[model samples]
Target chain A: MHAYANPARFLRIARWLMPALLAGGIVFAGGALAWGLFYAPAERLQGETVRIIYLHVPSAWLGMLGWGGIAAASFAEIVWRHPLAGVAARAIAVPGAVFTAICLATGSLWGRPAWGTWWVWDGRLTSMLVLLLLYAGYIALAAAAAASGANRRVAAVFGLVGAVNIPIIHYSVIWWNTLHQPPSLSLSGSSMAPGFMWPLLGSTLGFTLLFGAVVLMRMRMLLAGAQADSRLRRKALSAGEAA
Target chain B: MLKPKHQRMVLLAAALTALLAAVLIAAWALRHQASYFYVPSEIKAHPPEADRSVRLGGMVRRGSVHNEADGVTVDFIVSDGRADVPVRFAGIRPALFVEGSGVVAEGHMVQGRFEADNLLAKHDEKYVPREMAGMTAEQARQTVAQTK
Candidate 1:
């Protein structure tokens, strides 16, 4: 795992794997969306609104999962001082924010008619909103750190501190009164019937693959950017000596 | 072997340890402070105290809403298929407030009814009029005021 910390080696792997991931993701996610919208049974209760589940669930899952990536990278950066850890965190942030936005938007659409409300400041929804803010904070802090070359420590610390919200978001439904429904899927078992479960699982897999591809893509860019920056710094130093 | 500089490593370890401790303690303390919204089914599964203030959200039972003589005080039932909670509220009903839509009421279960001091009506993502979708900020305020 750590061997991939070398930017060149990681790029070698990502170059080949990205196309495959994107292809597979498109097939699965596109297939699931079509199936969910056209083929899946209208829920006895929610009716057509149930289709939004295909998009909302995957995006919601990835949003939190993105943070998990950042937290893990932050841990590696702090403990092992892995050179690529910051790059990985930076790579994951924006895509995660995008997914979080999708989740909120799709959820609101589904909520209208189904929940009869588009927005609520309930625990689950509020915490998810907070996650969006946290993502923005991280992206800004990381960019500033990369620019200054000093105080990058604050960005890593922010990554870990923001992780506290992940658990809060997960447990919010169980802890506070919120308009959002309780989780349908859990490790124990899914509350959804088998019919609804298959496409949801498929879409989640597809979205996860897409997310992985995006992260790798961003990592490559960040790695190249850093390399260029360092090269410029070395050149400037030598030029000063010559002068 | 991959090793961070010793001084930075020690600082990181200390910071992480403190953060872990703080997160754990905060989570533990927040357990009580955070109250999960209960659907009628869960409420039936484990009934909370009648006097304890709590929040309940679910689809309002169709045709169950009844406006009292005063028009402000209304009674309704919130249901999650498996269970139902009778709720009473003394205030103007929100424009979106309707039977069979999702609602959240907060207060206490008093005398067999969930007496809510605050009632929030939830709307779905669809626009009925369609034209209203393109409304500007000023138009939105005017529309709201007109409704009031």
Candidate 2:
């Protein structure tokens, strides 16, 4: 991993990797969405409203996974002080928040017909909302740190602390009798039939790939921007001395 | 090179202090602000504050829904198999709010009766994804009932 920490080398490889991930993500996600919408049968209880899960579930999963990545990167930043860890955390933040917002919006649309309400302040929903807020806070903190070139520890600490919500979101249904249904898929084995599970799994994979591609693209942009800024700063300093 | 040892130490201390503060605030808020709903069995075991808003979630008991002539005021019973709580609402009913399906209502107890201000229907047993298609709502309810 450290071998890729060299910015120029990383960018060289990422330039090729980004398009591959994007194309793969588009194909897989688009195919899964089409399959889920057109081919899957309507649920017995939810009827046609069940189609939203193809997008909603994956976004929700990515939302949580995004924070989990931040927490891990924060760990690296704080403990090992990995040169690329902070960049990785910053790259994941905005995309993660976007996915969280998508999850909430899609869940609301799905909820109207299925749950009868657009939004509920139930444990699961509330905790998920908090996760989104946490992402926003992290993004703002990352920006402030970048502007000041301050110690990255502040954001890393926030990243670690905000991770508390992830477990809470996962267990909210069990701890509280929420309107949101319990997770169908878990390590204990899924309650979902294979017919529905296959498409959902495919969509989740596609979304994860998309998320990875987005993060890589953001990291490369940040790297290039930093390089440009430093080059400009050196030129200005030399011109000042020459004058 | 890293920052001076003292600078690093101070920053680490500051971060720890901030983290501690956040943890304390979260714990305090969650204790008071978090609202957990109860099923009928749980409600019966220990009723919550009658004046405080709480959520009551369970299946809509079959044949218990009574729509008043006003068409806005409706009465129903929510059951968790072992116990039941009667809920009354004076509002527009949702299109999916029906008998023998899952429902969650937001309200507090009024003299042991739930006076719900809003209703949220639940898609219980829908995520199962097998034997659901071609089955009408009633048949699905019966299948769920038989399984219970």
Candidate 3:
């Protein structure tokens, strides 16, 4: 972990990993989309509209997963002050926000045909909304801190504090009455048939890979921007000293 | 007072505004396709104009269910216990949709009957998914007896 904490080494590894992960994500996502859309049986009730679940469920999973990634990265930044951890955390914010938006949008779409409402103020929906708001707030705070040259440690602390929402988001459905259905898949046992289960697993893996690729690419761009900014600042300081 | 950093912040604000605009427009465009729910009494009193898709929800009347010749399409009565409405849906019924059970039917009102394109079983506090909260003691016993 300490060896990988070096930004140069992390960048080197991510450079190769990003392309492979992106390619694999595209292939897997395409296959899952095809299987879910055409090959999988139409929900005996919902017909074609049920195919939306393939996209909706995966995006929702990634939204939560992206937040978990950010929290873990933030922890590393705060605890060990790992050089690249802050970058990892910062890089995830945009994609996390996008996934949260997708989750809410697609969930609303699914709800219309499935639940007969575009939105419900149910426990599950409310908690997911809170998750989106938290993501937005984190991004805003981090950006403010970055632009002001405020301490990154302070931003990392904020990240850690805000992460308390994760478990609440996870357990909200269980804790309160909700219109959303409970998770169909469980670690203890399989509730879904193999046809449904395999595609879901594939889609989840694809989504995870896609998240990693996007984060790595963003991190690269951020590192480059930071390096250029620091170089310009140093040159300006030297000129001021000479003057 | 507007420094380079302040200008960057303004740019971020503009980007956020654009993002919000895109999201709102997308939501609005899809609003008609979104789902709407109604109780059986509501459907009975104000049946939506023909061909407008909607959902009808209520308890399944005790003995009004009948298996159709096609076997897939079933005719049943949904009641608030005060007012009853007939529903015809050609699809697999949800596992929990039975007599005395709360149910939601999705489709449109056609002719005199509520023609459901989809069926969902709504559970009460007493009934939750087995995987999450597990079955109640009564349900557990019933399952055990069925296995034997």
Candidate 4:
């Protein structure tokens, strides 16, 4: 873990990993989406509408996972003062927000067909909405901190604090009498049939890989910017000394 | 007792733990408000004032759905096994709003019956493939009703 504290070394590793991850992500996400849309059997009750599960579940998973990543990176930034941790947290925010948005949109579409409403203030739905809002808030806070040249720890602290919502989002349906159903998948097993399960798993893996690739790409860009900024500063200092 | 960075880490963990505890307590205290709807037994036990609007949710009793003489109105009984609440709604029912399926109706109680302004269908977590369903739709309905 500490070996990655060196920016050049991190960039060296990510240079190769980024394209590999992207290619793998595209292959798996594309194949799974195709299978879910074209080949997966219709649900007994929901029919073709059930196909949305492939996108919705994975997006939901990543929405939470993204926050989890932010929390971990923030911890590293604060505790260990890991050099790349702030960059990693920043890189994760946009993709996390995007996934959260996708989850909400897909869930709304599914709800219209399955739940007879486009929106509801139920526990599960509301908490997921809150997760999206938290992402938005985090993005804005992180941006503001960056612009003002404020301490990045301000955003890292928020990242750590915001993590309390993840568990609430996870257990909302079970804790409250929600209109949305309980989770279809859990630690014990899944309620979904094998026909839907395989494609959903494949798509989830694909999306996760895609998410990682985006984060790495952003980190690389941020690191490159910092390195260039430092070199320019050094050049200016040398010029001033010569004068 | 620890390095400065380690001390900060411990403090951060404590603060987050306290925050989580606070959130959990607040949520627990407001659990009733967090619930989207009340079941029949809950309504019977508490019986909110007739004009105070609330959502009543449960399964539609298998044989209780009836279309009133008015073209717009439908009447049905929502049962949570132990109790039942009769509901009347004047709106287009959702495609999934079938007998023996879950429903949530929003409105107020009038005399004894619930007068619903909006109706939304609810579904269970089960997701069987069409081929694996084995039972006919009617049989599936009956099975759902029986499970209640």
Pairs that clash in candidate 3: A112-B35, A116-B35, A116-B36, A117-B35
Q: Arrange candidates by DockQ, descending.
A: 4, 2, 1, 3
Model 1, stretches more than 4 Å misplaced? A234-243, B1-33, B36-103, B106-148
lDDT string for model 1 (A157-232, tens) is: 8998898889878877666556665687888886555557788899999999899889888888888888898999
Tell me the tens digit of each residue's lDDT in model 2 across A88-189.
Answer: 999999999999999999999988887777888888899999999999899999999998998788999899888878878887776566788889888777
Candidate 1 chain A weakest ten by summed lDDT? A40-49
lDDT of 3 by residue, A61-89 (tens): 88887788887787677556678888888
Candidate 2 docks with a DockQ of 0.32
TM-score for predicted model 4 compared with the true structure: 0.93
Off by over 4 Å in 3: B1-148
Fraction of native contacts, model 1:
0.21
lDDT of each: 0.80, 0.84, 0.73, 0.91
Range of the 10 consecutive residues with the lowest summed lDDT in candidate 3 chain B:
B125-134
State which candidate has the highest DockQ.
4
Candidate with top lDDT is 4
Question: What is candidate 2's TM-score against the reference?
Answer: 0.83
Candidate 1, B34-144: lDDT as tens digits:
544667776677777976877787888999999899868998999988888899999866655777777877788776678898776654322222233356646855765
- The digit string of per-residue lDDT tens for model 2 on B4-115 reads 6546556765775677678657755664345456788878888888778878889999999998998789999999999999999998777668898888888988887899
Best by TM-score: 4
Native-referenced DockQ of model 1 = 0.13
Residue-wise C-alpha lDDT for candidate 4, range A16-78, written one tens digit per residue:
999999999999999999999999889877889999999999999999999999999999999
List where candidate 4 sits over 4 angstroms from the true fold: B69-71, B134-148
Candidate 2 Cα RMSD after full superposition onto the native fold (Å): 5.3
The collision pairs in model 4 are none
